[model samples]
Target: MSTKRYCYSCDLKNDSKLIAEYKAYHAAGNAWPEITKSIKDAGIVDMQIYLTGNRMFMIMEVDETFDPVKKAELDAINPKVQEWENLMWNYQQELPWAKDGEKWIPLEKVFQL
Candidate 1:
């Protein structure tokens, strides 16, 4: 099946120790099972996050069943998802232009060749 791709970015606290801990949490099989299950249940087939300095970029590929609105709704009702977000808040910061409560700000695509 074909998938759609989305990109987003967020910033990390400028503390090296926090960055290291964040990286460790995202290491292979280290993410909370609840969080992983929630992502798969949301129709996200694949996702990757990359870090440079204190900035993070994420790429996500989702199946046709995926809907961002529905995903957000689902997350809003899931305690585990809320827990993960709250915990991650310790290491993450909203983009300068992000609205209140926004963490990962979607990136507009440009110059694709």
Candidate 2:
């Protein structure tokens, strides 16, 4: 299995609202279930989410054959997923380096074990 880490930052001031939005979006929209289903359908082996301070992280172990671009396209096409993203955007602010509609920017790995 191969693993990847996704990192994103939230505004300190908007953290509470962002967290609330995340919870509400997942709970009301059944987003977590859908996400899990999609991941499993796409042959992901394992996944985990974590947060620290204003930083959010997701670790995923996906099948070697998984196509990221296709998965991204599928995400965009899911109405409930899109709705969840829209809801979360209300409390989300772009990072200093992000373009419009981008809530989280990827952090470059400068060092790794």
Candidate 3:
């Protein structure tokens, strides 16, 4: 399967609450459905999220016909997706290396199995 990875760090404040919210959001499934719709609309395929310590990661299997730049452009104009992001941002903080409006950064893979 094709894969892509994204990584981001979170601020320590309200860490427990943030984790709880992440769990709850996933449990509800609506958040994920919304996200998957966005991805599919952008021509991407299956995706998943994982966490390790303070970092969050996303793995996506992009459609062979997907255009990454176009997908990003479409993502920028999606109001409902933006609304979801804004809600989550309530519990999110800018990481030390992040610029404004960036919640997660695309990570370069150094090694993989």
Count of backbone clashes, every candidate in sequence: 0, 0, 0
Clash pairs, model 3 backbone: none
lDDT of each: 0.96, 0.63, 0.66
Model 1, global lDDT: 0.96
Q: What would the per-residue lDDT of candidate 3 be over residues 1-113, giving only the tens digit for each residue?
A: 55443443444234777777765775645566767688787656676667665456666666566777787777778887777777777766666788887766677677879
Ranking by lDDT: 1, 3, 2
TM-scores for candidates 1 onward, in order: 0.98, 0.67, 0.75
Better of 2 and 3 by TM-score: 3
For candidate 1, lDDT tens digit of each residue in 55-82?
9999999999999999999999999899
Residue-level error in angstroms, candidate 1, position 78:
0.6
Preferred candidate (TM-score higher): 1 or 3? 1
Q: Cα RMSD to native, each candidate?
A: 0.6, 3.5, 3.0
* Total residue pair clashes for candidate 1: 0
- Which has the higher TM-score value, candidate number 1 or candidate number 2? 1
Best model per TM-score:
1
